[model samples]
Target: MRKDRMILRTPLPDRLCHWAMVVCFFLVALSGLSWLFPSLNWLNGVFGTPQMARVLHPFFGIVVFAALVYLFIRFVKYNLFEKEDRIWLENVKSVTAGDHSKPLRIGKYNAGQKFMFWGIMGLICVLLISGLVIWRAYFAHLFPIPVLRVALLLHAVAGVGLMLLIIGHIYLAFWVKGSIRGMVTGYVSHAWARAHHDRWHDQISGKGADKTKPGSAR
Candidate 1:
């Protein structure tokens, strides 16, 4: 059955930031593709060419990195690790088996989502720092060759990690019902929240609601 009502939630700035992050990452991904292989050289057309991608990849990374920095500054506190997060982690089986009844109650972001948040943060940090070590013609010259080489390796690993993380993030978001809408519309149906991210819905709406009993509709 489809839901009759939903709610407005995420702030305008947050929605904008989320989309900007997604868009910037796509641009970065495209530019990075140009660098991944000579056969994929045509991918550089988005930015210009291989040489152009060389110049643009780091620039694009800066944009994505900056946007993420803004998001991090805004939500890092809310996403901090907590005791409930541990319980949520321990009960992963229940969460995965479609048995949330006995699972730990959560807040804004669930344990899985929070873990991904941190993973994204870690990837961002690694990418930025490593991208810098080899971002020559200006800064790379300052670092030792050996250090730069190590940075090169780290940069590659971070790139792969980011790709996998993004794929996993999108899969899970789409996997869960009503999740995509919350991201796109910034709101979700009251019932949708109760079913998937109840704690977050409650935290946003005020307090938890009785799932077994009918209540005022939004």
Candidate 2:
């Protein structure tokens, strides 16, 4: 619980952007769901009224897409695959069991997180393109009836896919003890970082079993 023992994980701006996107994503998602299901139509109250939800959903969806773009640009470097990631992939079951005894050489993100990051990005891109094509207010008139139907189908599928991914993301964020705290406060304990992201912890703290030690000694 020592403040001095914490290392910066998410910075303030990124944290702000993340929470903002969360809000926008939920509002847009719920509103879209309201339109898609008669039973869920009441969910449009997220924007006060069904009509208002209809008017606001697309705009909020655009905001979510823009925020994700910023996040992708900021975090893409940490999410790239590396040779060490193969070790993590091989022993993923151990990781699922909450065992860090294996030296997975995890960096700022593990392979699983990298995959989720890219998956979310890819689905959002799909949603944006399809949404644009089917947007009745602005673009639908330009497209033929058959094209609009196709776009609508694609948009629905991508939206559902993204929602599923976000659900898993939420579950993992809460399942990991310190993960949510790191996102909320922009810092995490050295021990938490070492346990979850050993290689990154070593690189940032300049200590531990870093491969660089052998090179330096030589």
Candidate 3:
């Protein structure tokens, strides 16, 4: 936990954005589900009342989308697939078992993380587009009834899919011992980085051919 022994994994700004987005996403999701399921109608009170929830949900959804766009710009390079990602995929069983004996040459984000990153990005795009088409206060009036219905269906599907992916993301964060701490503090111990992201550790530590420039990963 000492500064000298820890590596910066996420910068403060990124962490702030991430947590803010989390708050907005949950509010938006809950309000969305309230309308999607009659039994959960009470959830619409998240924004004080069902009427307020209706007025704010779309705006909060936009906030989530914008935050994700910022994150995508900041981390997409690290999440892109590389030749070494194949090793992580091949040894996924070991990874799931928490075995770190083998050096998988993992980078800042592994193959599974890359897939999750892309999946989230893709789903957000779908949600945004469909949401706009079905947004009664805005663009909905421009579309035909049939088009609006299709957009509504797509919005629901994409919203549900994004929520499922986020659930999986949270589960994995908890499953990995140091993941939540890393995100919260923006730092991880050298041992943690080495064990989970060996290649990235080496780069930052000046032990690999590609030395990480100062502030590059932030």
Candidate 4:
């Protein structure tokens, strides 16, 4: 049965923070490229010079970390695991095929997204710690030489991992048709919700059957 549309999914602050993080990540990526590859000299033009990028990357890393921390704190509850996650994980193939039968009946986030949330959080922690260790003007010399070496290697690995995760994140967002719109406009249609998240849809729209509502029939 077809249903009406919804108003919005994400809140304004969430959307704003998401975009800000995107911008900051892009800046960091560009700055890294400018210095990481001497052969790719043209990248320096994006930030005026390689030296200039070196100066700015750390500053914007702080910005990205702060914005990401805000997003993490606000959405942490939404990403917590629920019992339905097991069903969702087991039905991954069917779910990808667009199956909604006995759908997991998730609340805020599904299993896959919850995994991503924690994975990214770990990446952020690693990035921040390693970043501080190698921050030449700040703490590079304070740490022992052995520790600094390990930190540099870890920073490189974390950077690569985050980039790959980001690509996957964008892919998933676009894969779910209404997802991009949620982050872009902070709203979603009722139909989109019902089709994609039937259980959540019913709760939000006060549909025929809603388990989340009090005094409702099971």
Q: Pick the candidate with the highest TM-score.
A: 3
What lDDT is obtained when candidate 2 is compared to the true structure? 0.87
Residues forming the 10-long window of minimal summed lDDT in candidate 3: 209-218
The local lDDT score (0 to 100) that residue 209 gets in candidate 1 is 45
Rank order (by lDDT, best first): 3, 2, 1, 4
lDDT of 3 by residue, 94-175 (tens): 8999899999999899899999999999999999999999999989999999999899999999999999999999999999
Task: Candidate 3: give the clashing pairs.
Answer: none
Which numbered prediction scores highest in lDDT against the true structure? Answer: 3
Model 4's C-alpha root-mean-square deviation from the true structure amounts to 4.3
Q: What's model 2's lDDT at 20?
A: 99
lDDT of each: 0.76, 0.87, 0.91, 0.76
> Worst 10-residue stretch by lDDT in candidate 4?
209-218
RMSD to native for every prediction? Answer: 4.8, 4.3, 1.6, 4.3
Tens digits of per-residue lDDT, candidate 2, 1-218, equal 66566777888889999999999999999998888889998898999988888889889999999999999988898898999999999999989999988777888898999999999999999999999998889989999999999999999999999999999999999998999999998888988888998888877776643443221110
Q: Local error of candidate 3 at 200, Å?
A: 0.4
TM-score of predicted structure 3 = 0.96
Residue 38 local lDDT, model 1: 76
| Regions of candidate 1 where Cα sits further than 4 Å from its true position | 1-5, 37-39, 208-218
